[model samples]
Target: MRDPLTEKPRRKIPSRLIEVDAWIDSSLWRFGHGFSRFWESVTIFSRRFRARGLNKLAVEVACEGLTLGVAGLIVMLALAQPAMKLTANGLPQQTDYSVLFLDRHGNEIGRRGVMRADAIPIDEMPDHFIKAVLATEDRRFFEHWGIDFFGLARALSENARAGGVVQGGSTLTQQLAKNLFLSNERNIERKIKEAFIALWLESHYSKREILSMYLDRAYMGGGSFGAAAAAEFYFDKDIRDVSLAEGAMLAGLFKAPAKYAPHINLPAARARANEVLTNMVQGGFMTEGQVVAARRQPATAVDRSTTTSPDYFLDWAFGEVQKIAGDMPHRNFVARTSIDMGLQQLADESVEYHLRQFGKTYDVGEAAMVVLDDDGGVRAMVGGRDYGESQFNRATKALRQPGSSFKGYVYAAAMEAGFKPDDKISDAPITIGRWSPQNYGRSYAGTVTLQTAIAKSINTVPVRLSQKIGMDKVAALAKAMGVESNLRGDKTMALGTSEVTVLDQATGYACFAAGGMTSNRHGILQLFDTNGNLLWDSKRDMPPRRRVLSETASAEMNQMLSQIPIIGTARKAQLSMTRAAGKTGTTQGYRDGWFVGFTGNFTAAVWFGNDSFRPTNKVSGGGLPTMTWQRFMEAAHQGIELKPIPYIDNTMPERKAPKVAEEGDAPPPVRPASLTTAAQKVLAQIGMLMSSAPPLEKPEKLAAAAGDDNAVGRR
Candidate 1:
């Protein structure tokens, strides 16, 4: 303000304001420079054209045309960069996800993901197939460059006459370009780009190469993509083997794949195929007689059995796969499972039939079965009566009391503690805490051998033994034998109050079958990726089995259990062809019944109950469960040779089976009938007192006095 003459005191400008001012000046100068360059280009072209001695009107019109051409070129250049970025390298590589499962013998058991055929090459395609595609898709494919001008005129006239888009003028190259680079949006700009890219594709590739790309990348019906996949999916045949009618049908799928799918709508598919054949006839590629013969040939479809309902094995294997390869992102993989499909089918049928025939009589609504090898490989599993109705997988998920089946562990512990099969144990009532446990029939057998007690399933013997050996010790033995359920360390636990899954019970029983070695139960044997690369092998990854029970204890326990079918409750489970040993368990209220048994070849467990946990109508493990087990086992062991179990004849060396009690070996001294009345009265009084008293304070002492050895009563 003080120096007006000296360019006025430029009010000391802020540094930021001065920079912004300079930027604005530079931007304006650049914009002017670009405008001048554009103007100069237009002027130079106009001058060049005018210099060729053109008339005034022609020059004006030529300049206008040149201006529009330049504008369009600029617009195309603007779009080309993004289009190039999107397409990258022509078409994207297809990533298809397909999973196939096979049994141990490599027979296809089931499959997951969309069905696809093998890849087919264009050179191997027949001339009839190529002609069909060309006649249906593009009539002027050989004559047109990229955009079919005559075809466009014809299509426009046809559409105008029909009042709808009855025909499309797009060449095969244009369709390929749209599929490769752009979305399926119909607009003026997209059409322009499609035309341009079609020209580009035509210039870069031969007619055969273009057709090959088109056929290879086209999407067909039924989750199949390409000619090869379509051929196999529809006809169950290779691409080279597809007949003339089939090829025409496949080509017709290009219009509306799902709408004209043969499996979905045969009439629509056949009509479309007829239209293709007519086009072929018009194009001079097929005679009317050939068309008639082709029309007469009905479509041959793939078998539907390959897509049958998957069993429990597949459900279990897929869950494990998810755990191994979290989220299962691969498009294709192979799961090799241990299931025997034939046995699995039999098991499923058995379960359904049993439920239908005897469900109401037994008051049972559901059942589950699991068959495992001694090595812990699950061979077959039926989780429910109907897989379509529910996929709960009860064999591996549902937990119910094992009941008497768990008594094996109690006896196993007793044998470990130096108890023999010939040892005497009391079957009389005993009081532990406020609970007075009684026998199953409320009857007692006095002075019975341990083998007799087990054969008869006396409730008092196992409880007495569990009390003698700590309750915790019995539970520990059960865990070591592969029972994974939580068990209570109470005297009542000897009665199998703990609940366990059928899989765990089967695995636990398998440990006994395997001679005291415990193995990890699993369904999948191996897994592979799409390229046949091994992903996981159960044999390599599974932990080695540990010897949990001694050979003596295992053999003694198996021998005692084998008596169940021979003389005890499970008499119906006896097989005519082979011998089996197992235990039957029925819960207190008859709510849950189980029969877990094993032959040398297979160990199986069956459970019957209502999912609501309501009590069944007096259903016992020895009845319906044993019946189902026998049915499955009879079928499973039909053609297999019999082999002895690990403890078929193995017995304890320390204890020998006692001889039958003779007349002179009787207890409570017997006197001649001529004895005095005073002695008889005294004996009668003592008998009354003994009946009222608890079991002998030291039955071992009485056993000693009676000339018996190793006799111990329940503590």
Candidate 2:
């Protein structure tokens, strides 16, 4: 179809058409252009030997200089970019450790991310794994002194053949040098700088050491950096568990994890892993048998846990442990805690159940609980009455008045100081100075025994007893018993005018459950390496000692508190448990309700309060907190050994206490003439009083008045 004219050689241009083609080639044309430019740029006035101002030598020198300049230009194009120099003052290590929550059984209940370095060691990695890595990423990793001239030559030659630079020849050291020290700019300058620094690094560190550091610090994808972390993320196994295939899979991901993740495509991942395995086997880093073993099984996964989700218990424990143990990341320590996951779950459920009851009965939506082991180990904790509303740890942080429950402390102190539970104290209009404490019903139960007063949470009785034992000593006694709060100074302190956090209150009661010894409230027990090497061992366990209470003192307190259901305040907590002691508390205006109790093996405290600080409509500890406490204790005590309170002999004749008042200028309560016999008899038998006593009539005003005191419970 071509025209005859086009197909024909258009007139063989006079002969030697092929010679013209050869003359016009790039090399020949370049030389011809240079000659033409040289001739065009030349300037001559006359014969060089005839010049007036210049001699033949000067002319020759100028020509030689121009020729040298041309030669320099050719040499410049032939050289390569040189390496960079190393410098110190590099960035600090980007080290991070995570925090985890574990139960009493040593199971991880919950966790925070960034706890990856718990296992794995770089030194244990296979040699073949390293060689395979070097072959795939940077073959000249060891051969080059930070740069490879021959490789550059080969690259340039290949690029010339292909028409552009297609692949680079960066050594591993060069990459590390760039990754750790230089900007990721793709240019000759950056590459030169990378080369220099890599050479400096190789000069300072051995090949093995440098390789180890690189593996420990390099990014390995999946949100993990370093070989150990990569191993855990992909296989849920340590570096020790890594076989040839697993190691290959890990090594393969360093270049481009996004393009090859096991989760996204196991086949591609496995194929790449196999390639790595082949490299390892060929290189003699691992035997074919090891590779087979790794391939025999799929990657394992970490154990699933209930603490997986954000939860009230986890949140509370996370913060509480930090408070007690100091701020620590999960990797910073291997902590053994005292929590019972089962009991914690049970407590969480109970809190929900009890709060639901309030939702039905009182249309309320709140509850909280704290359970401790017999040894004072915090086992199960619930912060809010309703987790749906908030995540605040009311068990440890909430500061609320301990209504009638406060009465137990007062009575325990009084009974320990030699006051008998049967001795009567008159409640007939007795005033010390200006204050007058009232009973729960706002009615006087004249001549109530100390036991009955505490049993019924008789507010006036404690005030009268404080007058006998001196409230100062009572406060000291409470503080000594782990009631870390400053006791109330005013007469209302008898009615819990002071505030105490649920933590102290709960642990304070745990003193009794722990057999009168102090139970140091803490969570962390030991810190160890993932390999079981001891790092830090916490031996600050607060043991139960006589610091708890005299068995007799604790026993009498328990017996009297037991009457809380039969003859006193906490009648609602009469669940079918053999041995239990609890007291209900309701602050003034019902702003707060509390139920703190103890069994032989466990101590628990519960509180219900509104954020707005408004009084609940007829809400008492018995109604809501009791339900929560009972449920929590029921489950928290399931596997725990439940026994009776230590035997406290209460048969001693009632010891008469001296009428007392605060130090400094304060008047004492006066015994009226009309009520003298009744007052003395009641005062003489202050331990025999109860709600059954008849109210006495007063003839005149009191003789001694109370001192205006301002003591309050502050922890």
Candidate 3:
């Protein structure tokens, strides 16, 4: 309406509004001028300040501080790299299963795993026991954070005065952090990570929680973990039921479990316990009168010397259980292993007796043995002289040269290539690629049968046979027979220059006992949960045995090997009541001596050597190893019917395949069903013929097996 097209509008605004707009514009212009003048003055003053050198010094200091902060951050990240890579799946909770091991007869032999399931709550622990640990390990644990500077200074002073490390400065929380997340490596990086993780644990858990974790996670001696397990292991009582003296001894083990383990060193453990009592008195945790009784009556551990643990066998069987049922959610297991405690005891005693009797004379320090049934179930394993002195399982872990014992595979390969056990071969000196394999006595037997050549352990026969049949075939045949160790396809492999474990020898020899079937070596027989649910049964889950060697080849090998105990290098390995078959192996320089043989009931491999690989004093496979084998086998065969080896004289009944369980009987169904009546009748007739059949007699002479003269040429 005011615009009204192009008509001029009348003035409707008040004069006061025009005056106010003019005033605001003048004020803004004056303010802009003042700010410009002030900025210029400040810039001039800053330039003057820079010229005085203090500003330069301040800037350099700030830059140095920034650089140091960045470097420290980089170092800290590097130190924490190990911790950062760890997954927070279970945190401080142990992921390993607590395994209670029982022998073949269902008798509890030992226990393995960390025993985290047996952890006792902090509130259930005795007050005096807590005071004992705190006084000996960390007196000011409750008063400090994760780290205590005053305690560290005092420890340093005490160490300086003693000229050695008399005390540890780490608080209980720090120890818990280390046990939970770090290895026992003594280095600066590990220490830094431990300190940082200690801070993290302190922030995440209370003092009681930290102490409880420490008590649960620390490793005590004799394969026990946590205070609860240690209490049961040492005193044969629960942690809450232990007296003050026993608690003091338990607390002393935290410093050095191996050194002060009551089961191992009672005197040293008592001395350490006395020290704990003194510490309790000096820390004001207990008065002299309160600790006097504990000091007087030192804790005594239960007698474990007479108790045979079979720790090495348990170690191996525990590993097998882990492999079979590792993915299961339940972590507490009761494993029924294939170990026979009677045979295990005999094996241990045999090894110890031999080592004590002839060890010094032969200058041999270590020996290992493995015994397996025809079904490939491990019966007994002697890893070393004593489990306490060393825990390395030589039976399952150590790999040494097999020597002449390996000739069985080479001969088996030859038999597979259509050569008979009585086939003639030249036993004269021969060489292959600058390698002249001589007999153990360095004497040649001229022309001889394969049976005689193996019986005497002539080196040149196998070399010639390997050259004719090819080394690859020999290696493959050995692998097929269940030699799990690596076999080199070389000329020397015919003489067992390749290395293998005692278990491998047993497995390979078991093939002969199994009538050429694969020996699926296994230690665990059945695994069960705490509630008695069967988690794994070896016969159900294990791979079925397949034919590795033809029946003819296996029969030939067994016939030839059976001659060894009767007239070969393994004469001492002959059992009193049962027939045995096996080959003897002696490495170069007498570094390793092995007698691996098998009865129809059991196959065993015995190795005698030094752990350092030092040469023994002329200890041949026929000597100490055979004697040990003889002693153990004689004891193992008592009170049981002796079965005849396959292909040898058959006086005993023939072995039949295990009867398969019928349907609706068990959850783990075996083969389809039992044999039919007609099939059983046919098998019975065959068994009668086998038992009544006469043994194959060795021929007086046989023609030489045709071969290329230049097949194994000397370089």
Candidate 4:
């Protein structure tokens, strides 16, 4: 048969004009076959379902769904908003960014990024380049109102002919739409929403705007995005300088950039580039000679910037940052961290060294360190001796019993309540109601001033003061200075039985170090947009801090902390430092050890323990933390001038008569009303025990108390 127009083969259906009619009929048949194949599967599945009685159930279910589905859809639509499309920002996306770190002096100390591109302008882009992209990626890009039904049908037909699903039907518009306004879930509902957004964008903007957006946002090879980044990544040149071959290669990657990256396999990428060039020539965007030149001069370079990952620092710092700013979006965050790379280096080195030293001298090798400036800012922190073996940041995270370190708070509270530093207090087994706390040695300091008791980190003295002033006042005092974690309302907590993280302890102690003014610990400094517009700053309109103690009381507290470095438990921390102060804390049964202290300008708290609440190698705050503090301070303030502190004598009036203990190792009974009968019985039950505590001539039984029983819980 022949058509009248071509005049080639004319034979059969002459009278009926069957040649043109047959062409029309065949096109419709092909279309029908494509749809029928899809629909026939559904019909077959339905027949099998009917055989199993499932068809009746399905019809019933569909009827119910038909009744409620519209209402459910309305509810969901009501719930959905612009923000609902967002989920928690994932770990730093697979983009390589250049980092520039500087000291407080603005001297650059670190560099990571290269092969970069800032941004590209829409007018500067070649029109033919965009046309070629449309030809290859979405042929009807400019023709349709966003989504194209005909293009999708053609794609389905091609896939059917190929005997496998070899092509995707997602237009560039659909992809951009999804990237901007929909979640990336692979389902029909999301695709429908993407189409809606794309249609809206098409209606609101011009063709040039859509094309510019596509060129700017589409991901390219080697952790690059947009035409400009792709150009620099592939050829080490700007977008304006890209050759025809390079341009086509960049365009080819819109489907799967990683699979076609030149660095992954250059020969395959060059072949794809040649195919793109052929398409460009066919589309009349480029000449045949251009294709030949593009193939001849292939890309000579490929970006290798994605090879390294900041695995350790990124993993560690991300957890820390989330503590302060988890609610802030990850996209526009600027954490003005006090993290000094040099100080962090020193911290890592000191943790390794001191634990090794302690491992040799004693059996405890585990350690942690948390350093902060007296400005109420964290400076350097090491949560463990080895972050590689463990990620639990004990410095900022773990909440272990603070042991004698808690005595500092008790002593401070007593001082404010008129217990003078020079006033003498007996440190023996003293019973306050049902609780009795023994020293770490289970011995007593017979008669010593408050200064000597605290200097030696005495446990009994604090227990006495907590009873005299009442545990309510002590807990309130702790809370006032920023120890927001729970503190025991009962007398048992007075001996530091309650658990707290090293960070809160360091921060609470830092308040005293900073002359009694509280500054809430902060991490982020300010934030800016990608375009460098100011978004937020941490220093804006902050509240005035509450004063927790008088300067005179704070000075006395600092005096006790200073004894640690001068003549007490933390003497090893004295790196020729004059104005240093800190306290040592070892938990009951040696499960945790902490050393938290500060000088005039810095406060650092170090802790050591396991997250599973297992014991470490008998480590204490004085063991590794003291040495780490010394090492950090040495490097941190090198050649910086500082002054010495002068201590003053106590001038406050003394409180009422107190309880005193004898040289014995007996515990008090639970909830006793009278001291003699209950104390005697509890001692007899414990086997190796008792004498009535060498009785202080009773002046008065302690007053009744009011506070949380577990006032201090683990931080």
TM-scores, each model vs. reference = 0.52, 0.50, 0.65, 0.49
lDDT of 2 by residue, 1-715 (tens): 7798875676566457777777679678899999987776563433434644466678788889999989977654343233322355443344354444455544555433243344244467765567668656666666777677777787688888999876566767776776576644356766757766777778877787667667766655443557776676667776666765666777777666645567555677777777776656665666788677666653432332222222455555545445444453324333456776666666777666655545545544455677777656677777765332333556666667777777777787787888777888877666677876666677887787777777777677788787788777767766766676656666677778788877777877776666566766655554433323334444533343556467677777777776675555675555454556778888888788888887666788888776556677666887677766765665554433446655533232222222212112322122111323245357535523432344222100010000001211100
Best by TM-score: 3
The lDDT for every candidate, in the order shown, is 0.75, 0.62, 0.81, 0.62
In each prediction, how many residue pairs overlap at the backbone (N, C-alpha, C within less than 3 A)?
A: 2, 44, 0, 11
What is the per-residue lDDT of model 1 for residues 414-442, given as tens digits with 9 covering 90 to 100?
Answer: 99999999899888889988998888779
Over 4 Å off in model 3, which ranges? 1-95, 115-227, 240-244, 251-291, 302-307, 650-715
- Supply candidate 3's per-residue lDDT for 294: 85
Residues 591-708, candidate 3, lDDT per residue (tens digit)? Answer: 9999999998999999999887889998899888887787788777776657788777844323222222211142211112334436646874674466434422210000000011
Better of 2 and 3 by lDDT: 3
Q: List the candidate numbers ranked by lDDT, top first.
A: 3, 1, 4, 2
RMSD of each: 25.7, 30.5, 19.2, 27.6
lDDT of 4 by residue, 1-715 (tens): 7568665344454845877888889999999998999899999887775633786788888989987998888875654433234322421232233222222222222222222234467677655456557767887777888888888998899999999886778777777776555544455566666776676678777877777777876656554557776776677777876666677777777776766778766777777777777777776777888568767886555656434212233333444444444354423222234455555666666666656555555456456666666556555666665442333456655667887778778888887887777999887787666766778768886999988887788888877787789889888887887776787687778767787777778778878777777856653343322222334444562356767887778888877777666667776666443457778888776677777777665777777655556666666667655656666675665544443332423222232211212202322112112224255356535522322233222101100000112222111
Q: Counting only residues 3 or more apart in sequence or on different chains, how many pairs clash (N, Cα, C under 3 Å) in candidate 4?
A: 11
Off by over 4 Å in 4: 1-331, 359-365, 643-715
**Ten contiguous residues with the weakest lDDT in model 4:** 698-707
What TM-score would you give candidate 1 relative to the actual structure? Answer: 0.52
Q: Tell me the spans in candidate 1 whose CA falls farther than 4 Å from its real position.
A: 1-99, 111-308, 326-332, 649-715
Worst lDDT run of 10 residues, candidate 3, spans: 698-707
